[model samples]
Target: MMYHLLPSPYESQEINHLTLAYFVISSLDFLNSLHLLTHKEAVSDWVLSFHLHPTTIPDPNNGQFYGFHGSRTSMFPPDQTGALLHNNSHLASTYSALAILKIVGYDLSNIDSELMLSSMRNLQQSDGSFIPIHTGGEKDLRFVYCAAAICFMLNNWSGMDKEKAKDYILHCQSYDGGFGLVPGAESQDLHVTFIEMMYHLLPSPYESQEINHLTLAYFVISSLDFLNSLHLLTHKEAVSDWVLSFHLHPTTIPDPNNGQFYGFHGSRTSMFPPDQTGALLHNNSHLASTYSALAILKIVGYDLSNIDSELMLSSMRNLQQSDGSFIPIHTGGEKDLRFVYCAAAICFMLNNWSGMDKEKAKDYILHCQSYDGGFGLVPGAESQGGATYCAIASLRLMGFIEDNLLSTCASSSLIDVPLLLDWIVQRQGTDGGIQGRPNKSSDTCYAFWIGAVLKILGGYDFVDSKALHGFLLACQYKYGGFSKFPGEFPDLYHTYYAFTASSMLEESGFNSLCPELGITQVAAKGL
Candidate 1:
C-alpha cells in the first residue's frame, strides 16, 4: 500500500505528506543515491523555490525566522474563521532543502544567508519556542532541531534569541533529566533525546549549565535502543533496568507472557493510551522498532561486542519487503522507503550488511530519482531532505562511497573510516551546520543526522570549525535551548543534534568531546 501525497494533517493534510518528501530526499542524500536522480539542476531549483525571503519577525521576544510555505502552495492568511490552515515553509522542509542542495553538490552558492536570517528573526515565541514554519505548524523538538541545523550549517547564528531558548531547553527537562519535545511532557524518547542532546551540548552552557542533556540523553537513547529489540541495549545494566520497569506493554511485550518491552514507550506515548500495544503501522514489519532500538543503543553506549549482531540484522532482514526495502510494521502490507533507511542504518550501526539488500533498495531509490536529479521517498515520489539523508546514510553505512559521493562529501579520504564520511559531508549546510534540504529554512536536528552522517562518512574535515561554532552559538535560544532555524524555540531532538554537530566540529579541530560516535580506533562497537 503506497502512501498518498497527503494534504493536511486532518482533512487537507499536507504536512505529513510533504514531510515524508523531506525525509525521502534527506534519506536519499544519506544513502549516496544521487545517481538515481533525474536532473540535479531542476531538483535543486525546485527545492530552493521554498526559500521565502524578506521574512518579517513575528515577535522580538525571541530571535526567530518567520514560517514559509511547505509545498508549492501557500497556507497562510487565515480563512474567515481566523484559523490558519498551514504554511508552506516547514522547519523540516528548510532542513530538507539544505540537505538536498548539498546532495546535489550545490555549495549553496546561490543561498542568501542574510535573507534567511531576517526570516528567522520573525518566528520567535516569547517563551523561547518557535512555530514550525511561518505560523507554519506546531512547535516541537523536530522543528527546533531543524532551526539549529540551519544555524550550524550557515556558519552564522545571528537569527534567534539565546537566553529564552536556553531556558526553554532547560524547562523541558524531566525529573529523570531527559528532555522531552515540550515542557511537562511525559517520559523522554529517542527523537527528543537526540534534539535535546544537540542543544544541551551547546557551548557556554548559558542558563542550561545544570541541565546535563547528555546524562538524560543517555536514558532516552537507551530506551529507544531497547524498544528496537536490539539486544545490546536491552542488556545495558541501566538501560536494561529501565526497560524492565517502565516500558513493558502487551503489544510490545517480547512474549505474550513476558511483556518485557514497551511499544515505543519513550516516543510521545501520549498519542496512544499507555496500554495500547501495536501502533497503526504502515508495514507488517516494525522497522520503527529497529531504528529506535539502534538509535537508543548508539545513545546508551551499548557495546556491540556483548550482543548477537545477527539478531538485529536478522530481524531487519526478516522484514524485508518484496521491493527490497524494509517495512516498519510486521504486516509487510505498506512498504515505504523509510524502512529501507531504518534497515540500512541498522545494518550500518551493526557494521553488518547481511540484513540489507542494497541492490534492490538502491534500485528503488534510483527509480524514484526524478528527472531533477534528486531521489524521492518511494519510486516516483518527490525528493526530500530527510529521505535523502536516509538514502545517503544507508549507502555510506553500506560502504558504497563513490566519486560522486566523495565530491558531494567533505574530506573525501575519510570515506574509508567505519562511518560513511562522504554522506556526512554532503549533509553540511552552506552555513556550516547541516540542514535536511535546500531553499527551505535550516533546522537543528539535521546536525545529528547530517553531522553524525558526516562523522560516519569520515569527512569531519570539510566542516569549518569556527564558522560552525559561531552558528551553534547564534541558534541558541535565550531560554537556554537550541532551534533548528535561528530565533526559534529549542527542543530535545534538535538540541542533541546541534551538540553532536558541535562535537564533530570540535573533534575535527582535534578537541574530542564524547568519542566522536563510531570512532573507537578499532573496537567492533566503534565500527
Candidate 2:
C-alpha cells in the first residue's frame, strides 16, 4: 500500500527505498498481482540505478569494491579537477537490488558480474564470514550466508572463500549445540560468561533476571536458519516446549483483555497496572516476546496448528490503546511506534486485523510524524530512522501504500508524499551512510530502517548507490564484521542490519529478502 504523499514517519528512511521496493514488489508477487504494478520498467531501472561502476583507474585494485550505494544522500561534490569520487560497493545492497530486478523480469544479460564478484571476493575474511560493506562490520554466520547466497545467485562461486566460511560456521557451534554470531567469539568477559553459564544451567529464562528471552530465542532460530543448521537441532521439540511455556493465560493475566498471551517470563504472577507496571509502566505481556514466540514457532515448522489463535489475538487486542498506540504489556509503559509496528506485525503474521482498530491506529501513526517528514517516538519528538520505520511499516501493513497505487486519491488526502521524499533523500551524508536524524552520524541500522522506507516510497533509484556503499565500507572492520559507524566494534544487531542494507542497496549475491518478515524470500517460500 502507498500514499501519493510520503508520510512524516517515513522521512528518516529515505536510504532504504530499495528495501521498501522489495516489500512492495514481493508482496505483489505473493498476491499474484505483480502485473498490476505500474512502471515495471521504471522500477527495475531505479533498482539498477544504485549500481556503482568502478572509476577508470588503470589497474584499479583498491577500487574493486564497486557495487551499489544505499541511497542518493551519499553523493558528494566532485573535486575541482572533476574526477568522480570513489564509492565502495556493498554486498547486501548488490544482492537486494538484483533480486528486485529479477523479480520484475529485468534482463540481467548486461549486468557486470565480474565487477560484482570481484567486490564480493574482497569482503571475505580468512574465517569464511563475508563483511557486508567494504569498510567492514561484523563477520558472522549471517554474512557468510549472504556471501553464499550472492555467489549462488550469480552462478559464481569465485566471490566467496566457501571452505573457510564453512569452517567459521562449524566453529560457531557452541557447547549447548547453538551457534553464536561470531566464530570463537562468544563473550569473553569473565563476569558475562559466568552469568551466561548460570543462565543456561537454569531450566528457564523466567527464573533468571535481566534476560530478554525473546532476543535469545530469535537469535538462536535465526542463526540456525542463516547457517542452514535447523536440521542440527536434534531437540526441536524440547526447544519448542520451552518456548511455549512463556504463554500467559487470561486467568494469569491481570488486565481486562483476558487472553492467552506470550511473555518474556512466567515468573510474574500478576499483571502490573499502568502505574505500577515495571516494563513501560504496567508489567504484562511483551510485544517483542510475542513476535519472537510466533517466529520461533514458524521456524520450527510447527504450523501453529496447536496454538490458541483466538486467545492470542484477544491478548494482542488488549494491548492496544485508544490512541492506536500499543503498550508492550498491560501495565502501560512507553507508547511509541515500536510497539505499534510490533502490533501490526503480529496481526499480519496472524492473518488477522482485529487485533487493532486500523483507522485509529493509522491516525495515531500520523500523529507521531514530525515536521521534518520523519516519524518520532511521539508528537514533537525528534525524528529517528527506527521510529520512522515502525510508522511506515505499520502504515504499509494497514494498506496506505497499496491504496495509493490502486486509487486516484489526491496526495493531500493521505500523507505528504513530496516533502517526505525530499526529507528522506537528505538523510544520506557524503560518507555514504544514512543518518537517523539531522546532524547525527550515520549508523549501520539505518541502512535497513531508512532504506526499507525509501524502497516503499519508490524513490530508491534517486540515491547514490556507490557513495552509500563506500560509507558502509568505512564502517566495516578488518575482522569480518560491520559496526554502527566507522571504526567501531561490530555487534550482531548492527551487522545484521548492515547485511540487509547492503542487500537492498545493490546485488552482493543473495536471494531477495522479504522485508516485512525480515527473511529471505526463498526461506519464506514454504510459508
lDDT of each: 0.52, 0.66
Highest lDDT among the candidates is held by which one? 2
- TM-scores of all predicted structures: 0.43, 0.55
Per-residue accuracy of model 1 over 1-527 as CA lDDT, tens digit each = 02223344444644443455566666666778757677878777776766654334333333334333466555355457543344355666677677667767777656777667666756656657767756446665555667777777776687677676776666566545677786534422333344334423543543353223323444334323222312333345675344322222334423322211122233323224432446423222245544454454455555644445554455455566667766654443457666677677666666778776888877665555444444467878765555655655566556555423434544434223323333334555667665565555556666655555445434555766545655665676654446777777765445545545544553211113222222222222443
lDDT of 1 at 231: 38
**Runs with alpha carbons beyond 4 Å of true place in candidate 2:** 1-209, 223-238, 250-283, 403-412, 506-511, 522-526
TM-score of 2: 0.55
Q: What are the C-alpha RMSDs, in order, of all predicted structures?
A: 26.6, 21.5
By summed lDDT, the worst window of 10 consecutive residues in model 1 runs over: 255-264
Error of 1 at 454 (Å): 5.5
Cα lDDT tens digits, model 2, 134-235, are 777766777788678767777888777777777667656543467777632342122123323332453343345334655555644543444334565677
- What's model 1's TM-score? 0.43
